[model samples]
Target chain A: MDTPLREPTYLILTALAREPMHGYAIIGEVAALSDGRLSLRPGTLYGALDRLTDAGLVELDREETVDGRLRRYYRLSPSGASILAAETERLRRNVEAATARLRARKAQALTPRTAGGLA
Target chain B: MNELERRYRRLLRAYPPDYRRERGDEIIGTYLDVAGPDRRWPSLAEAADLGRGGLRQRLRAAGATDLIPGVRLAGLLALTTAAFLAGFWVFAEQQLPPAEAGVPVFGPFVSVGIVAWCGWLIAALVVAVAPGRPARVAIGVALLMTAAVPAVSVLAGVPRPPLLVLAPMVALGVLALAVDDGLPVLARVLPVTAATVGGFLSYAMGVGAYWGAYRGGGGEFQPPIGTVLLLVVLLLAIGLGMRRDARGGWAAMALLTPVGLLNVHLLAGAVDGLASGAPRPTYPTMVGVALAVALLGPALLPAAVALRRRLGTPSAAAPCPTCGRHR
Candidate 1:
């Protein structure tokens, strides 16, 4: 499975990692997770959904009646979960490296001005 | 339900033809079901948004190969340009050194030049509508001849006038001959009205200045040659401006005629030992201004007629470089 995914795709996969839901429900979940930082236009949403479907990481699970309208539910496949895990691991490694560097820089700043070091 | 379906149907039009062919009805049905009574009639803003999107999609689907429609549009534009130019030329010609003035023999040549140009424009339109290898070749050849023929005629001492005058004259005449191309009439109307208004304003200014000088006991004013030339140029520019097919910014520049000429006159008058201020409106000066205005008035018809033809047809938008598609 391809481990790297676009941020939006990763978020969508993360949302579906819990349970299958329709397009609108998934949009709401993603918005909730992002604290309303992201909003999707219908065209963009559908276009992205189409591309994701072709990638096989996401699949249409079922059709449901929502407010008396037909809605297709989507779910992340097992391969999607593995890809999400890999992305998380990659993020974790970057964070660890950055944190270590920040701690070393902090210690160095605290060491006060020394004539020998300046020279 | 009906209104919602209609709205959805309208929205579905934004899709390409192939997409519409496959899923138009389904998409509308789906949208109707989703929207239900909650949304009801679409808002005016939404409708406009949908229309713009749909038009873009339709254009994209139509692709760049639809030269036929554009050619038809161009034909109409050609007619409008021709009509406007012709009217402007006729109206402006009266200001030219009258044949009786014995300035030169460029007078008769101007009229003939206009007629011949009109003939070429008519031929171009016929060819545009009935385009093919032969028609294309004919149009190309005609355009070449139209460009070259006048130069030859002039060089051979056939009395061809300068292109500054000939350009507008030919444009208007050609538009007239191609009037059948079905360009929108308003394209010519708006510009003519604008140009007319501008010309009238300049004339009015000239007259008012004359009246002021006449009353002020100022020195006798003589209309400068540049002023006369500027007036003539503006009259023709007005005709050009009247057409939608005319270049943008052209109409605005036409209004600047008086300002331009005044600037030239202001400098030249001082250099030539005249007063350092503006030209005073004396009897002879008023007469010159009035005469120039009157002479230009007759060209309105030919200008309108030519502008009408050109405006009826417009050109295609610039082509996209990457896609080789017209916008």
Candidate 2:
């Protein structure tokens, strides 16, 4: 079995899941998706990009020059898409189970006998 | 270049030369794109990332220096496992009276297994020296022999294989298939040292006769718990000292040997018990086998991915010897 994608890899794939993006665009999107929790520095982002490209999970889509700087676009490969989907499903199941348990605990707390203690 | 770009360019030297030639400009461009105009130097996180990224690339490049690290490591593992198995079979053949030993003993299967082992040993040696299509074919045939021994026996109406005997063969096939043949073959000295250490472990564990072939309640049945614990500790050390050793396959093979033994013990017990019309051993051993398989599952995939990158890289060579003569 393949190694499960790490948080950064997952986030990067998520960013590219919708459409191809340049390096800075991916960093911004990853941060936005995480609600400012993940701010990918260029070094980290490019390193990941290079590794991902090497692994065949991500590929360069196009390259254009903006303000005399190279802006290379990358998109998730088919394998990358499936990996992201599988990881998402796993996380969703975990969250669902945790929320279900929490809801059950809350319901138990709302029972009449438990409510009388607060009164 | 401006001062900040110049500084970043200097730091880029830490990356591999080939990598720098390919991706350096793009990296520099990305850094400039993200850098604030007021920023004078790289952030600590950025510097750390570059250091790590560069180091990772360098380490990978080192694998390509002489031998393809992936294939050679796989070859070493195949070689050592064959040697270990061959040595044990020799000992078991010399001693271990048949009356004391039961159906699932080494001597029963050793003949064909020895052939396989010898083939594997030769394949590994070939992989070490030749690094060509023939060596790869030899490795394939050797691994095939491992499964074929048991298979041919069954076709000849022999009793079903002691599953423990089968586990390592299965693992060898799986791992061998996972490692791409395109990677360089580096001859790491540590694997030899690790093999010596493994020999010590074999001697200490009474590896030839872990259980079976003894009077009464059978041979010394030291629970796999100790083996498992030691393997875990050794694995931890491997991880911690990864910097010391670039080829992770040695520790991996060392770990696989015992896990293979434990798996054999568990499955052999079950199969032999069933064949003899006795109750198969219990849950704990099954769980142990399951746990070992689980640990093995995660270890293989990522290494395959990494090695595939090394092997599949267009310029790693003029296409590995499969389609053409060896470079």
- What does DockQ give for each predicted structure? 0.02, 0.20
lDDT of 1 by residue, B173-257 (tens): 3232322223244532432443344345435444422322322221232123224434544564466457633422232232222
Instruction: Give lDDT tens digits, candidate 2, residues A2-110.
Output: 3566778889999999999998899889999999988987767876776676667887787788878877788888988988889999999999999999999999988
On lDDT, the candidate that comes out on top is 2
lDDT of 2: 0.58
In candidate 1, what are the lDDT values of residues A9-115, reduced to their tens digit?
A: 77888898999866666767878888887654333444455446645667768765654455667788777677788898898899999999999999999987867
lDDT of 2 by residue, B262-305 (tens): 34444545644654554355456554754566476546535654
What RMSD does each model have against the real structure?
A: 22.9, 19.3
Evaluated on chain A only, model 1 obtains a TM-score of 0.84
Model 2 / residue B97 / CA error / Å = 54
Model 1: how far residue A92 lies from native, Å: 2.6
lDDT, candidate 2, at A1: 16
